[model samples]
Target: MKTKIILVIIIVLCTFFIGMMLFIKYYSPKEKSNQLLSNVSVVDGKQIISITAKGGYFPRITNAKADIPTTIKLNTKATFDCSSAIVIPGINYRSYLPPSGETIIDIPSQKAGSSMNGTCSMGMYGFVINFN
Candidate 1:
Protein backbone atom coordinates (compact mmCIF):
# COMPACT_ATOMS: atom_id res chain seq x y z
CA MET A 1 0.00 0.00 0.00
CA LYS A 2 1.09 3.64 -0.49
CA THR A 3 0.88 4.27 3.25
CA LYS A 4 3.05 1.27 4.05
CA ILE A 5 5.73 2.39 1.54
CA ILE A 6 5.80 5.92 2.93
CA LEU A 7 6.12 4.65 6.49
CA VAL A 8 9.04 2.44 5.53
CA ILE A 9 10.78 5.32 3.78
CA ILE A 10 10.35 7.61 6.74
CA ILE A 11 11.69 5.01 9.15
CA VAL A 12 14.77 4.44 7.00
CA LEU A 13 15.52 8.16 6.79
CA CYS A 14 15.16 8.57 10.54
CA THR A 15 17.49 5.68 11.23
CA PHE A 16 20.11 7.08 8.88
CA PHE A 17 19.95 10.52 10.47
CA ILE A 18 20.37 9.13 13.98
CA GLY A 19 23.35 7.06 12.93
CA MET A 20 25.03 10.08 11.36
CA MET A 21 24.49 12.15 14.47
CA LEU A 22 26.03 9.54 16.71
CA PHE A 23 29.03 9.21 14.42
CA ILE A 24 29.72 12.92 14.46
CA LYS A 25 29.26 13.21 18.21
CA TYR A 26 31.63 10.40 19.19
CA TYR A 27 34.08 9.84 16.35
CA SER A 28 34.77 13.28 14.97
CA PRO A 29 38.09 14.91 15.66
CA LYS A 30 37.37 18.01 17.73
CA GLU A 31 39.87 20.82 17.51
CA LYS A 32 40.26 23.84 19.73
CA SER A 33 39.00 27.27 18.79
CA ASN A 34 41.58 28.95 16.58
CA GLN A 35 42.02 32.05 18.70
CA LEU A 36 45.42 33.75 18.52
CA LEU A 37 45.32 35.46 21.91
CA SER A 38 42.60 33.81 23.91
CA ASN A 39 44.96 31.61 25.91
CA VAL A 40 48.00 33.80 26.57
CA SER A 41 48.51 36.20 29.44
CA VAL A 42 51.32 38.04 31.14
CA VAL A 43 51.65 38.06 34.92
CA ASP A 44 54.39 39.50 37.14
CA GLY A 45 56.83 39.81 34.27
CA LYS A 46 56.21 36.26 33.17
CA GLN A 47 54.12 35.04 30.32
CA ILE A 48 51.65 32.39 31.37
CA ILE A 49 49.88 30.32 28.77
CA SER A 50 46.83 28.42 29.93
CA ILE A 51 45.36 25.50 28.04
CA THR A 52 42.66 22.99 28.79
CA ALA A 53 43.04 19.23 28.56
CA LYS A 54 40.02 16.99 28.44
CA GLY A 55 38.80 15.27 25.31
CA GLY A 56 41.56 17.25 23.65
CA TYR A 57 43.85 20.23 24.19
CA PHE A 58 42.04 23.54 23.58
CA PRO A 59 43.25 26.77 22.09
CA ARG A 60 45.73 24.54 20.37
CA ILE A 61 47.83 27.45 19.21
CA THR A 62 49.00 30.35 21.39
CA ASN A 63 51.24 33.38 21.02
CA ALA A 64 53.40 34.68 23.85
CA LYS A 65 56.37 36.87 24.62
CA ALA A 66 59.79 35.37 24.01
CA ASP A 67 62.26 37.37 26.10
CA ILE A 68 60.41 37.16 29.40
CA PRO A 69 60.25 34.07 31.56
CA THR A 70 57.49 31.72 30.60
CA THR A 71 55.28 29.02 32.04
CA ILE A 72 52.47 26.85 30.78
CA LYS A 73 49.56 25.97 33.04
CA LEU A 74 47.49 23.01 32.03
CA ASN A 75 43.98 22.71 33.44
CA THR A 76 42.53 19.27 33.72
CA LYS A 77 39.23 18.08 35.12
CA ALA A 78 38.13 14.47 35.13
CA THR A 79 40.53 13.88 32.26
CA PHE A 80 41.15 10.17 32.11
CA ASP A 81 42.25 10.05 28.50
CA CYS A 82 45.72 9.77 27.00
CA SER A 83 46.00 13.57 27.14
CA SER A 84 46.64 13.30 30.90
CA ALA A 85 50.16 12.11 30.07
CA ILE A 86 51.74 15.26 28.70
CA VAL A 87 55.13 15.33 27.06
CA ILE A 88 57.24 18.24 25.94
CA PRO A 89 60.18 16.68 24.22
CA GLY A 90 61.81 20.03 23.55
CA ILE A 91 62.17 20.64 27.28
CA ASN A 92 62.75 17.02 28.23
CA TYR A 93 59.61 17.24 30.34
CA ARG A 94 57.05 14.53 30.80
CA SER A 95 54.50 13.92 33.51
CA TYR A 96 51.21 12.31 34.37
CA LEU A 97 48.89 15.09 35.46
CA PRO A 98 46.30 14.78 38.17
CA PRO A 99 42.80 13.96 37.02
CA SER A 100 41.45 17.34 38.15
CA GLY A 101 43.96 20.11 38.87
CA GLU A 102 46.47 22.54 37.48
CA THR A 103 49.92 21.48 36.27
CA ILE A 104 52.42 24.25 35.90
CA ILE A 105 55.52 23.87 33.76
CA ASP A 106 58.41 26.26 33.58
CA ILE A 107 60.17 27.04 30.33
CA PRO A 108 63.47 28.72 29.78
CA SER A 109 63.62 31.92 27.82
CA GLN A 110 62.98 31.26 24.14
CA LYS A 111 64.34 33.10 21.18
CA ALA A 112 61.92 35.35 19.35
CA GLY A 113 61.42 32.95 16.48
CA SER A 114 61.33 29.80 18.54
CA SER A 115 58.26 27.72 19.21
CA MET A 116 57.36 25.07 21.76
CA ASN A 117 55.30 22.02 21.10
CA GLY A 118 53.68 19.43 23.35
CA THR A 119 51.75 16.27 22.79
CA CYS A 120 49.77 13.69 24.66
CA SER A 121 51.56 10.45 25.42
CA MET A 122 49.71 8.78 22.58
CA GLY A 123 50.32 11.78 20.29
CA MET A 124 46.66 12.01 19.48
CA TYR A 125 46.39 15.52 20.95
CA GLY A 126 48.82 18.43 20.79
CA PHE A 127 49.40 22.17 21.28
CA VAL A 128 51.86 24.78 20.14
CA ILE A 129 53.17 28.03 21.62
CA ASN A 130 54.88 30.50 19.38
CA PHE A 131 57.12 33.18 20.85
CA ASN A 132 57.53 36.58 19.32
Candidate 2:
Protein backbone atom coordinates (compact mmCIF):
# COMPACT_ATOMS: atom_id res chain seq x y z
CA MET A 1 0.00 0.00 0.00
CA LYS A 2 2.80 2.34 0.90
CA THR A 3 4.55 1.60 -2.40
CA LYS A 4 1.38 2.39 -4.34
CA ILE A 5 0.91 5.66 -2.48
CA ILE A 6 4.51 6.69 -3.24
CA LEU A 7 4.07 5.87 -6.90
CA VAL A 8 0.86 7.89 -7.14
CA ILE A 9 2.43 10.85 -5.41
CA ILE A 10 5.40 10.73 -7.74
CA ILE A 11 3.13 10.64 -10.77
CA VAL A 12 1.06 13.52 -9.52
CA LEU A 13 4.11 15.58 -8.82
CA CYS A 14 5.56 14.87 -12.20
CA THR A 15 2.28 15.73 -13.91
CA PHE A 16 2.04 18.99 -12.03
CA PHE A 17 5.57 19.98 -12.91
CA ILE A 18 5.11 19.12 -16.54
CA GLY A 19 1.88 21.10 -16.71
CA MET A 20 3.55 24.07 -15.16
CA MET A 21 6.43 23.92 -17.54
CA LEU A 22 4.13 23.75 -20.51
CA PHE A 23 2.06 26.64 -19.26
CA ILE A 24 5.09 28.78 -18.78
CA LYS A 25 6.45 27.89 -22.17
CA TYR A 26 3.26 28.47 -24.10
CA TYR A 27 1.20 30.91 -22.13
CA SER A 28 3.77 33.26 -20.68
CA PRO A 29 3.81 36.78 -22.01
CA LYS A 30 6.43 37.48 -24.59
CA GLU A 31 8.38 40.65 -25.32
CA LYS A 32 7.71 42.13 -28.68
CA SER A 33 10.17 44.23 -30.72
CA ASN A 34 9.08 46.51 -33.52
CA GLN A 35 10.59 49.01 -35.99
CA LEU A 36 8.97 52.11 -37.47
CA LEU A 37 9.79 54.59 -40.22
CA SER A 38 8.01 57.55 -41.77
CA ASN A 39 8.23 60.27 -44.37
CA VAL A 40 7.51 63.96 -43.67
CA SER A 41 7.46 67.02 -45.85
CA VAL A 42 7.75 70.60 -44.62
CA VAL A 43 6.91 73.21 -47.16
CA ASP A 44 8.13 76.80 -47.07
CA GLY A 45 6.17 78.90 -44.58
CA LYS A 46 5.10 75.80 -42.62
CA GLN A 47 6.14 75.64 -38.99
CA ILE A 48 5.19 72.09 -38.16
CA ILE A 49 4.36 68.83 -39.83
CA SER A 50 2.28 66.31 -37.96
CA ILE A 51 2.05 62.83 -39.34
CA THR A 52 1.51 59.36 -37.90
CA ALA A 53 4.25 56.83 -38.47
CA LYS A 54 4.09 53.04 -38.39
CA GLY A 55 5.33 50.79 -35.56
CA GLY A 56 4.33 53.36 -32.94
CA TYR A 57 7.14 55.68 -33.97
CA PHE A 58 6.29 59.37 -34.05
CA PRO A 59 8.37 62.22 -35.37
CA ARG A 60 8.10 65.54 -33.59
CA ILE A 61 8.69 68.64 -35.64
CA THR A 62 10.23 71.77 -34.18
CA ASN A 63 10.96 75.03 -35.94
CA ALA A 64 9.52 73.61 -39.11
CA LYS A 65 9.70 76.96 -40.87
CA ALA A 66 13.19 77.98 -39.93
CA ASP A 67 15.92 75.67 -38.68
CA ILE A 68 13.51 72.77 -38.44
CA PRO A 69 14.21 70.19 -35.82
CA THR A 70 12.86 66.69 -36.07
CA THR A 71 12.66 64.25 -33.24
CA ILE A 72 12.06 60.56 -33.73
CA LYS A 73 11.41 57.70 -31.33
CA LEU A 74 12.38 54.22 -32.32
CA ASN A 75 11.84 50.91 -30.59
CA THR A 76 14.25 48.84 -32.66
CA LYS A 77 16.75 48.90 -35.50
CA ALA A 78 15.04 50.55 -38.46
CA THR A 79 15.80 52.34 -41.69
CA PHE A 80 14.23 55.61 -42.81
CA ASP A 81 14.54 56.41 -46.48
CA CYS A 82 13.28 59.30 -48.57
CA SER A 83 13.11 59.66 -52.29
CA SER A 84 15.14 56.48 -52.58
CA ALA A 85 18.03 58.23 -50.84
CA ILE A 86 19.73 57.59 -47.54
CA VAL A 87 20.80 60.44 -45.26
CA ILE A 88 23.78 60.08 -43.01
CA PRO A 89 24.30 61.76 -39.67
CA GLY A 90 26.43 64.96 -39.35
CA ILE A 91 26.50 65.19 -43.10
CA ASN A 92 24.20 67.44 -45.07
CA TYR A 93 21.33 66.42 -42.79
CA ARG A 94 20.02 69.96 -42.75
CA SER A 95 17.57 71.27 -45.29
CA TYR A 96 17.79 74.77 -46.76
CA LEU A 97 14.98 77.31 -46.39
CA PRO A 98 12.50 78.17 -49.14
CA PRO A 99 13.36 74.54 -49.20
CA SER A 100 14.72 74.28 -52.70
CA GLY A 101 12.86 71.04 -53.19
CA GLU A 102 11.89 67.87 -51.44
CA THR A 103 14.79 66.13 -49.76
CA ILE A 104 14.54 62.48 -48.77
CA ILE A 105 16.23 61.13 -45.70
CA ASP A 106 16.64 57.57 -44.54
CA ILE A 107 16.93 56.49 -40.92
CA PRO A 108 17.95 52.95 -40.20
CA SER A 109 17.60 51.06 -36.92
CA GLN A 110 19.79 47.98 -36.86
CA LYS A 111 19.55 46.59 -33.37
CA ALA A 112 17.16 44.28 -31.60
CA GLY A 113 15.34 45.00 -28.35
CA SER A 114 16.48 48.59 -28.28
CA SER A 115 14.80 51.97 -28.56
CA MET A 116 16.31 55.15 -29.92
CA ASN A 117 15.32 58.79 -29.71
CA GLY A 118 17.05 61.54 -31.64
CA THR A 119 16.56 65.12 -32.69
CA CYS A 120 17.79 66.64 -35.95
CA SER A 121 17.32 69.78 -37.94
CA MET A 122 14.96 69.97 -40.86
CA GLY A 123 13.70 72.64 -43.25
CA MET A 124 10.96 73.40 -45.68
CA TYR A 125 10.58 70.90 -48.54
CA GLY A 126 12.05 68.31 -46.24
CA PHE A 127 10.49 64.90 -45.97
CA VAL A 128 10.81 62.09 -43.51
CA ILE A 129 10.56 59.97 -46.62
CA ASN A 130 10.44 56.21 -45.87
CA PHE A 131 11.71 53.74 -43.36
CA ASN A 132 11.94 50.00 -42.73
Candidate 3:
Protein backbone atom coordinates (compact mmCIF):
# COMPACT_ATOMS: atom_id res chain seq x y z
CA MET A 1 0.00 0.00 0.00
CA LYS A 2 1.08 3.60 -0.47
CA THR A 3 0.94 4.12 3.29
CA LYS A 4 3.48 1.39 3.84
CA ILE A 5 5.82 2.89 1.20
CA ILE A 6 5.60 6.37 2.69
CA LEU A 7 6.25 5.03 6.15
CA VAL A 8 9.36 3.26 4.94
CA ILE A 9 10.61 6.43 3.28
CA ILE A 10 10.09 8.41 6.46
CA ILE A 11 11.94 5.85 8.51
CA VAL A 12 14.89 5.83 6.12
CA LEU A 13 15.18 9.59 6.11
CA CYS A 14 15.03 9.73 9.91
CA THR A 15 17.74 7.14 10.28
CA PHE A 16 20.00 8.90 7.79
CA PHE A 17 19.64 12.25 9.53
CA ILE A 18 20.30 10.74 12.94
CA GLY A 19 23.41 9.04 11.68
CA MET A 20 24.75 12.28 10.24
CA MET A 21 24.15 14.16 13.46
CA LEU A 22 25.96 11.58 15.51
CA PHE A 23 28.90 11.52 13.15
CA ILE A 24 29.24 15.27 13.19
CA LYS A 25 28.97 15.51 16.96
CA TYR A 26 31.34 12.70 17.92
CA TYR A 27 33.75 12.28 15.04
CA SER A 28 34.34 15.89 14.09
CA PRO A 29 37.23 17.92 15.40
CA LYS A 30 36.01 20.65 17.80
CA GLU A 31 38.61 23.28 18.66
CA LYS A 32 37.74 26.92 19.25
CA SER A 33 35.80 30.08 18.51
CA ASN A 34 38.81 31.18 16.47
CA GLN A 35 37.91 34.86 16.59
CA LEU A 36 38.66 35.06 20.28
CA LEU A 37 42.13 33.59 20.26
CA SER A 38 44.84 36.03 21.37
CA ASN A 39 48.54 35.74 20.78
CA VAL A 40 50.87 35.06 23.69
CA SER A 41 53.27 37.80 24.58
CA VAL A 42 56.07 38.85 26.91
CA VAL A 43 56.34 42.11 28.83
CA ASP A 44 58.82 43.36 31.38
CA GLY A 45 60.50 39.97 31.69
CA LYS A 46 57.22 38.13 32.14
CA GLN A 47 55.60 35.76 29.68
CA ILE A 48 51.82 36.13 29.45
CA ILE A 49 49.75 33.39 27.91
CA SER A 50 46.17 34.24 27.04
CA ILE A 51 43.42 31.61 27.08
CA THR A 52 39.69 31.98 26.62
CA ALA A 53 37.22 29.82 28.56
CA LYS A 54 33.64 29.21 27.54
CA GLY A 55 31.98 26.05 26.31
CA GLY A 56 35.59 24.88 26.37
CA TYR A 57 39.05 26.34 26.33
CA PHE A 58 39.95 27.98 23.04
CA PRO A 59 43.25 27.15 21.40
CA ARG A 60 43.27 23.96 23.42
CA ILE A 61 47.01 23.74 22.89
CA THR A 62 49.61 26.45 23.38
CA ASN A 63 53.38 26.84 23.22
CA ALA A 64 55.50 29.14 25.37
CA LYS A 65 59.06 29.87 26.28
CA ALA A 66 60.73 28.14 29.21
CA ASP A 67 62.70 29.42 32.20
CA ILE A 68 60.95 32.73 32.63
CA PRO A 69 58.33 34.17 34.92
CA THR A 70 55.01 33.08 33.46
CA THR A 71 51.47 34.28 33.93
CA ILE A 72 48.39 32.48 32.73
CA LYS A 73 45.81 35.09 31.87
CA LEU A 74 42.40 33.45 31.73
CA ASN A 75 39.58 35.34 30.07
CA THR A 76 35.90 34.48 30.32
CA LYS A 77 32.89 36.19 28.83
CA ALA A 78 29.39 35.22 29.91
CA THR A 79 30.71 31.80 30.81
CA PHE A 80 28.59 30.02 33.39
CA ASP A 81 29.19 26.45 32.36
CA CYS A 82 31.35 23.75 33.88
CA SER A 83 34.32 25.01 31.89
CA SER A 84 34.38 28.04 34.16
CA ALA A 85 35.53 25.79 36.95
CA ILE A 86 39.12 25.26 35.91
CA VAL A 87 41.68 22.96 37.45
CA ILE A 88 45.38 23.13 36.69
CA PRO A 89 46.76 19.99 38.29
CA GLY A 90 50.34 20.68 37.35
CA ILE A 91 50.48 23.71 39.61
CA ASN A 92 47.82 22.61 42.10
CA TYR A 93 45.66 25.54 40.95
CA ARG A 94 41.87 25.35 40.98
CA SER A 95 39.19 28.00 40.88
CA TYR A 96 35.92 29.14 39.38
CA LEU A 97 36.17 31.93 36.86
CA PRO A 98 33.85 34.87 37.00
CA PRO A 99 30.89 34.97 34.67
CA SER A 100 32.70 37.63 32.62
CA GLY A 101 36.19 38.89 33.34
CA GLU A 102 39.86 38.09 33.59
CA THR A 103 41.79 36.01 36.09
CA ILE A 104 45.53 36.03 36.25
CA ILE A 105 47.61 33.25 37.79
CA ASP A 106 51.36 33.38 38.26
CA ILE A 107 53.96 30.66 38.63
CA PRO A 108 57.67 30.18 38.65
CA SER A 109 59.61 29.61 35.46
CA GLN A 110 58.98 26.20 33.96
CA LYS A 111 61.77 23.99 32.75
CA ALA A 112 62.42 23.43 29.08
CA GLY A 113 60.54 20.61 27.34
CA SER A 114 57.87 20.57 30.03
CA SER A 115 54.13 20.84 29.77
CA MET A 116 51.27 21.89 32.00
CA ASN A 117 47.68 20.73 31.72
CA GLY A 118 44.48 22.42 32.81
CA THR A 119 41.00 21.00 32.79
CA CYS A 120 37.50 21.72 33.93
CA SER A 121 36.34 20.57 37.31
CA MET A 122 34.47 17.73 35.63
CA GLY A 123 37.41 16.94 33.34
CA MET A 124 35.27 17.43 30.26
CA TYR A 125 37.34 20.34 28.86
CA GLY A 126 41.04 21.04 29.00
CA PHE A 127 44.13 22.75 27.54
CA VAL A 128 47.86 22.23 27.52
CA ILE A 129 50.82 24.63 27.62
CA ASN A 130 54.08 23.24 26.26
CA PHE A 131 57.38 24.90 27.10
CA ASN A 132 60.28 24.81 24.76
Candidate 4:
Protein backbone atom coordinates (compact mmCIF):
# COMPACT_ATOMS: atom_id res chain seq x y z
CA MET A 1 0.00 0.00 0.00
CA LYS A 2 1.15 3.58 -0.55
CA THR A 3 0.91 4.43 3.14
CA LYS A 4 3.05 1.44 4.11
CA ILE A 5 5.74 2.39 1.61
CA ILE A 6 5.80 5.99 2.80
CA LEU A 7 6.10 4.91 6.41
CA VAL A 8 9.01 2.63 5.58
CA ILE A 9 10.78 5.42 3.74
CA ILE A 10 10.37 7.79 6.65
CA ILE A 11 11.69 5.21 9.08
CA VAL A 12 14.75 4.60 6.94
CA LEU A 13 15.54 8.29 6.68
CA CYS A 14 15.19 8.81 10.37
CA THR A 15 17.46 5.88 11.15
CA PHE A 16 20.09 7.13 8.75
CA PHE A 17 20.01 10.62 10.22
CA ILE A 18 20.36 9.33 13.75
CA GLY A 19 23.28 7.12 12.78
CA MET A 20 25.09 10.01 11.13
CA MET A 21 24.56 12.25 14.12
CA LEU A 22 26.00 9.68 16.48
CA PHE A 23 29.00 9.13 14.24
CA ILE A 24 29.80 12.81 14.04
CA LYS A 25 29.43 13.25 17.75
CA TYR A 26 31.65 10.33 18.75
CA TYR A 27 34.15 10.21 15.86
CA SER A 28 34.95 13.71 14.73
CA PRO A 29 38.07 15.88 14.51
CA LYS A 30 37.18 17.77 17.67
CA GLU A 31 40.67 17.28 19.15
CA LYS A 32 42.78 18.16 16.15
CA SER A 33 43.76 21.59 17.47
CA ASN A 34 46.69 21.89 19.86
CA GLN A 35 46.43 24.20 22.86
CA LEU A 36 48.61 27.25 23.15
CA LEU A 37 50.40 26.41 26.40
CA SER A 38 51.79 22.96 26.07
CA ASN A 39 54.38 23.91 28.69
CA VAL A 40 56.58 20.90 28.21
CA SER A 41 60.18 21.01 29.37
CA VAL A 42 63.13 18.83 30.22
CA VAL A 43 65.48 19.15 33.19
CA ASP A 44 68.00 16.69 34.53
CA GLY A 45 66.68 14.06 32.10
CA LYS A 46 63.17 14.44 33.43
CA GLN A 47 60.34 15.64 31.26
CA ILE A 48 57.84 17.92 32.90
CA ILE A 49 54.49 18.74 31.38
CA SER A 50 52.14 21.34 32.78
CA ILE A 51 48.40 21.55 32.34
CA THR A 52 45.86 23.97 33.75
CA ALA A 53 42.55 22.59 34.89
CA LYS A 54 39.62 24.92 35.16
CA GLY A 55 36.58 24.30 33.04
CA GLY A 56 38.75 21.92 31.03
CA TYR A 57 42.35 20.97 30.54
CA PHE A 58 44.20 23.54 28.46
CA PRO A 59 46.46 22.43 25.63
CA ARG A 60 44.19 19.56 24.87
CA ILE A 61 47.09 18.14 22.90
CA THR A 62 50.76 18.11 23.77
CA ASN A 63 53.82 16.70 22.02
CA ALA A 64 56.75 15.55 24.14
CA LYS A 65 59.86 13.43 23.97
CA ALA A 66 59.73 9.76 24.61
CA ASP A 67 62.01 7.46 26.63
CA ILE A 68 62.35 9.90 29.50
CA PRO A 69 60.98 10.01 32.97
CA THR A 70 57.98 12.30 32.94
CA THR A 71 56.03 14.34 35.42
CA ILE A 72 52.70 16.06 35.02
CA LYS A 73 52.14 19.21 37.00
CA LEU A 74 48.44 19.90 37.10
CA ASN A 75 47.61 23.45 38.07
CA THR A 76 44.23 24.41 39.30
CA LYS A 77 43.29 27.90 40.42
CA ALA A 78 39.94 28.22 42.08
CA THR A 79 38.82 25.19 40.12
CA PHE A 80 35.60 23.85 41.53
CA ASP A 81 34.52 21.80 38.55
CA CYS A 82 34.75 18.17 37.62
CA SER A 83 38.15 18.90 36.10
CA SER A 84 39.50 19.14 39.66
CA ALA A 85 39.66 15.35 39.66
CA ILE A 86 41.72 13.75 36.92
CA VAL A 87 42.41 10.25 35.77
CA ILE A 88 45.45 9.03 33.87
CA PRO A 89 44.69 5.49 32.91
CA GLY A 90 48.06 4.96 31.30
CA ILE A 91 49.75 5.11 34.71
CA ASN A 92 46.74 4.14 36.76
CA TYR A 93 46.97 7.57 38.33
CA ARG A 94 43.83 9.11 39.71
CA SER A 95 43.59 11.86 42.25
CA TYR A 96 41.58 14.83 43.38
CA LEU A 97 43.44 18.09 43.04
CA PRO A 98 43.21 20.93 45.48
CA PRO A 99 40.98 23.82 44.59
CA SER A 100 44.00 26.07 44.06
CA GLY A 101 47.44 24.58 43.76
CA GLU A 102 49.70 22.28 41.81
CA THR A 103 49.73 18.50 41.84
CA ILE A 104 52.58 16.44 40.48
CA ILE A 105 52.19 13.03 38.89
CA ASP A 106 55.02 10.84 37.71
CA ILE A 107 55.09 8.76 34.58
CA PRO A 108 57.72 6.21 33.62
CA SER A 109 59.75 6.49 30.46
CA GLN A 110 57.57 5.69 27.50
CA LYS A 111 58.51 4.19 24.20
CA ALA A 112 58.54 6.34 21.13
CA GLY A 113 55.32 6.63 19.14
CA SER A 114 53.18 6.26 22.21
CA SER A 115 50.51 8.38 23.81
CA MET A 116 49.10 9.15 27.23
CA ASN A 117 45.61 10.38 27.86
CA GLY A 118 44.08 12.13 30.86
CA THR A 119 40.50 12.91 31.57
CA CYS A 120 38.37 14.45 34.25
CA SER A 121 36.44 12.33 36.65
CA MET A 122 33.27 12.58 34.59
CA GLY A 123 35.19 12.17 31.32
CA MET A 124 33.91 15.51 30.10
CA TYR A 125 37.30 17.23 29.88
CA GLY A 126 40.56 15.68 28.72
CA PHE A 127 44.04 16.08 27.27
CA VAL A 128 46.54 14.03 25.33
CA ILE A 129 50.33 13.78 25.47
CA ASN A 130 51.98 12.34 22.41
CA PHE A 131 55.53 11.02 22.71
CA ASN A 132 57.64 10.83 19.65
Candidate 1 per-residue C-alpha lDDT over 1-132 given as tens digits, one digit per residue, 9 for 90 to 100: 999999999999999999999887766633223343468878888888998988778778777888988889999999999899999999999999999999999888899989988999889999988899
Query: Arrange candidates by lDDT, highest first: which order?
Result: 3, 4, 1, 2
Clashes of each: 0, 14, 0, 0
- Candidate models: Cα lDDT each: 0.87, 0.35, 0.91, 0.90
Cα RMSD of all models vs. native, in order, equals 8.3, 14.7, 8.8, 10.4
Whole-model alpha-carbon lDDT for candidate 3: 0.91
Can you write out model 2's per-residue Cα lDDT over 96-130, one digit (the tens) per residue? 21212333333333233322232323221122322
**What is the TM-score of candidate 3?**
0.71
- Root mean square deviation (Cα) for candidate 2: 14.7
Candidate 3 structure quality by residue, lDDT tens digits, 5-121: 999999999999999999877665343333334447899999999999999997799988999999999999999899999999999999999999999999899999999999999
Question: What is the Cα-based lDDT of residue 14 in candidate 4?
Answer: 100
The numbered model that scores best in lDDT is 3
**TM-score for every candidate vs. truth?**
0.71, 0.30, 0.71, 0.71
Q: Please report how far candidate 2 places residue 45 from its true position, in Å.
A: 25
Q: What is the lDDT of residue 65 in candidate 1?
A: 81
lDDT of 4 by residue, 79-104 (tens): 99999989999988899999999999
